[model samples]
Target: MKRWIILDRDGTIIKDKNYLHDPNGAELTEGAADGLRMLAGMGYSFVVLTNQSGIGRGYFTEDEMNAVHLRVDEMLACSGVRVSGWFHCPHRPDEGCSCRKPELGLVRRAQEELGFSDADVAFVMGDKKSDLEMAEALGAPSVLLMTGYGAEEYAKGARGTLNCGNLRDAAKAIAEFEDGAARASFSRDLREHAEVVSAMRSLEAQAGAAASVIISSLRGGGRLFVCGNGGSAADAQHIAAELSGRYLAEREPLDAAALSCNSSALTAIGNDYGFDKIFSRQLEAHGRAGDALLAISTSGNSANVLEAVRAAKKMGIRTIALTGGDGGALAREAGLCVCVPSSATPRIQEMHILFGHALCGIVEKTLCR
Candidate 1:
């Protein structure tokens, strides 16, 4: 996947010249080209999201803007840097346009054109509150450069963004942070394995019971429906796949499906009945008495997952909760609760998959026999 940095143009990458329409007047800001080049070397691409109210105010034409952009491009080329996209909003503030700074239009357009979005970006970088606001909307981190209006904005208490002072410092800080994260995650995972082991050990009977519940349903030819949200959704799919497809040996395919796997049904249900009904609505359609649901949730508090559990109970379907931190309300609600005894999310997730494998193994061994 292409990692991106959604950047600002004027007052960020170039010296702010107060709506100059002349290409000859354009200048690269201090450390702008070099900083961009550093990030490019690290396999990062750039998208320029800017607000050019000058165009709407009739201070510059689109053709003139293009010429100035071309000039900026030449300067960037000197540093061996290239931007993947240039997205700007040409609307006055009073126009109430969606594409302006602090709005998401420019960033959204860039995401569409570039085939990447917030999930693929490292961070947004700019010298103003608008840039930070855009990053906030995308749910991505942002770099606040103390260039252009950055110092002024900072002085006025624009917080919650990484203030790296300037383009050069920002690049170095990002590089260091990335490097540190990469180095730490390896050791962190290893150290956290003890938590997983302890959690798993503490829940041996619960794990076996969760498996036996599914085995009984499978023996009775009942389908299994799994549901979760976000990362838990992925875990739900993984568990479903292992059962319905295969785990470690050749066997007859089991009946299973992830409620969140069908995008059409999920989206339509979510849109029509609200997000809380997304999973429960599907359960209503496909789940029958004696069928099983393996509801996965790290915190066991996902509204949709809980709703699904309630729906399953009303249908006389059995519910097994795979969750962490005392299993939230799901622990109390489910027929069986395999609570991974850790509050840390990652540790809980690790134990969840382990529990899923154990369940899959037990079911396959019992049924295939």
Candidate 2:
């Protein structure tokens, strides 16, 4: 999970020399090296995404531009900081190529080249409006340094971006923001998990009761049918796998199946009947008297899962619904409903898997004995 910062070259990293091809003219902006060193220490790699349109205008050759970059790299290397990638667009403003700033070409090219296509980029920092626009396009925050064209661009009104006096200030601001966000996120996660633990404690008796029913049904030669949609669907498959294979101890495989696992039956039923009938149709095929249907739905109102529960009831199969949000309509229909107290979908899903694992463990113990 590497994080990176996209930087503009001419004005942001060094003095904007304006088509000057002399490597001798390359001069680092005040505090540029120090800022870069700080960011590097914070686990951020750097990518110079610049618009070197002077090549398109025939002001300088690409070879001359490389010389300038080599000089810049040498200066940064003195400070123990390295640019992981350097991407420049050699198109004039009138060229209409996708690689220019405010377009995603250079950024996309750098991401692909550096193996960071799916990585988290902290922000884009530069001294021009085009840089901010590029950051916005990439769904990242922008830092506008009042170094080169930044003051003029700021006067022209580049709103909704962090405005700093220099690269050093920008780096400090970003570091502080990231640190605060990390701490706040940690605190929020801790609170949310604590809430989950409390909810689980309240639901312990109901969970135990559900495990008892599942154990009895399986011992009496009844199969378990599990079904849901989306993340809940994944949870359904996981729970079924735990039961039909083994939870903790190796024993005879239990008769269990996740209704969402069969892709052919799902697509055929969904295409012929509709999405709502996908689970119910599968339940009809596999469900029988004395069997149990473990229906998981975060919203408790997933049409397909609800339909499956109805079908299970009609076929004399016992229904245990793991749901959230006042249990929705599925709670009313199910014989036993374990509803996590929170309406938040993610929290509910976490509790559902915990409950599933606990139930599987209990069933494995009871049946093995």
Candidate 3:
């Protein structure tokens, strides 16, 4: 699925200037935050690609460049947008580094590190000819902005470039493209999964029951507890975010917690006891009667999660398990087990996200009303 849009930093994220390096001086252009907010809402991952030769020319240190990135990250963070990756070519014009813009080296590095396939990218937004040329090499579309050197680049007539007045417009176009694609993909997947609801009747009933329980607790102003490991950790946080706020729909926030959110507690527990006790220990401290624990496990056999489920049960908390095909011990541990009808890891993960999104919608519409 096309899930990412490459961005050129200077004129696209901030105003472009000759040899700009000060983080304190960095300022987001008009609609920059809103544009990013739009892309984020559509689930489009972002990556910034730029040529920062100032480092190689002794004009700025790598540390300064990182600080600039930090400032940018902070600015985006406030709006709930994250840059999945960032890349810069730190070479003089004559250095002939493969990573310099117009070369696919930096793009290749990002592809490898970020696991982005060129075939799946939708567009590259930039204010320069080099950015367009790079997008061409990767078979991705291009969006040209008329900011900074954009006028000069526009004057040169970049073939196939979608011209925009500023980054905000470009971002809007990109978000629309991504949203359309996501909806299409999601619809197709859901349709295919729908055919199996009859075969997985028991699991569906359990999921419905668990979702009803979640809606009840949330309606009563009780918080939810989520926990998992690795990718499931990300999923745990994701589900909680969707509950604590809106996923795509506008509604009042729900109270939710991911025991894994506190790094200090996790590290302390891991160090003092063991990895298996990290989540259970947190559950002991935070859980209360009637609170719900949403444990996510692809294999449904993660010992740490099983222990946490046990702890939550002991505390009289409602238990829900989001698991994959043939749920292991997690199915037994959970008061309600929603086993996604897939065994393949990727498909299971895909279903998990879809389920979480639907659950968020269900809980919000039911409780907020």
Candidate 4:
């Protein structure tokens, strides 16, 4: 759903001028255009409602007012801000017209045309008390800007969305309010993760099997090597750290290292044998019959990770894979593979860390004791 902003034109958007008529005189208030663009990016659309007494008072023609509005729109277009509706109450205050500020005529008319109701309005904003009054009529929130005649209203103790200094400040205030509202409620993101993990219960047997492979390799005085690419690469180093540092124990640190941790070797090998050989070349120099290599890839098909798995096997080193979905070629090639049920990369990565933690806990209990 599109969030809507009920806005006053002159003082709220452009510098308020006395009977603004000339298109050339239509200048945007400082930071107003940028703020509108920011709000627009956040899914807020605008409908400009203004009181133009200059037309009724014979100060400017209706055609002249439209020309000026067109000019303002041109300037706003440079910043990618498009006002959805343009409305003006061309009557003097003494005329007692229903379309003027503090009245609901124009706003109601906009609702009819724009397919929005008072409840759909996000906030009403202007540099005048009448603008806030418009919001009060709709029972919506309001923002009082410190531009144009707003200073006078502020001096008179008129409060809005906390007396914004500019449109930029007003936009920031609205965003902060939204963020606070979101934080106060339960997010759907945690629910998504819960669903992914709930589905992973079926992987229990596979995870236990993968953990057993690593434990047996370590128990025989064999080191564990881990490697991946991108986020998985970070996960590799993280898993290695848990094994090498201390996983809830005072025992000696396990012989575990992330092959990608050595930048010098990675770059030299990558430069010589190519990017595909970086992990495989590192495994060649370190792998033994008892050592185990943990290859992690969200897609289960990373070329470099596959190369590393193949090289570990050729050197008589045990291979274990952490992957997702159909488990790709790595699943079939590795000695053991724990595949996450989800096909989404983010969920797969999350499960990888969870499995990594489980492995750390399992091996620490057996090896440290």
Q: After superposing candidate 3, which stretches have Cα over 4 Å from the reference?
A: 175-369
56, model 1: CA deviation in Å?
A: 34
Model 2 residue pairs with clashes:
none
lDDT of candidate 4 over 1-369, digit per residue (tens): 678998898888999889999999989998898899989988999999999998999999999999998998899999999999898999998999999988999998898999998889999999999998988889999999999889999999888865798888888888898998787654665676789899988988887787778888888989899999999999999999999998788888998999888899989998998999999998888888889999999988999999999999888888999999989999899998888988888878998998899889988888888
TM-score of 3: 0.49
TM-score of each: 0.58, 0.64, 0.49, 0.60
Better of 3 and 4 by TM-score: 4
Kindly state the number of residue pairs that clash in model 2: 0
Clash counts for all predictions: 0, 0, 0, 0
Candidates' RMSD to native:
9.1, 7.1, 13.1, 10.4
Query: What's the ranking of the predictions by lDDT, best on top?
Result: 4, 2, 1, 3
Q: 334-360 in candidate 1: lDDT tens per residue?
A: 888888878899888888788888888
- For model 3, how does the per-residue alpha-carbon lDDT over 167-243 read when each residue is reduced to its tens digit? 67877766676678799999977776665444455555665687898887776767799999988999899999987
* Residue 235 lDDT, candidate 3, scale 0-100: 89
Q: In candidate 4, which residue pairs clash?
A: none
The digit string of per-residue lDDT tens for model 2 on 206-228 reads: 98889988887898999999998
Q: TM-score winner among the candidates?
A: 2
lDDT score for candidate 3 against the true structure:
0.84
Worst 10 residues of 1 by lDDT: 159-168
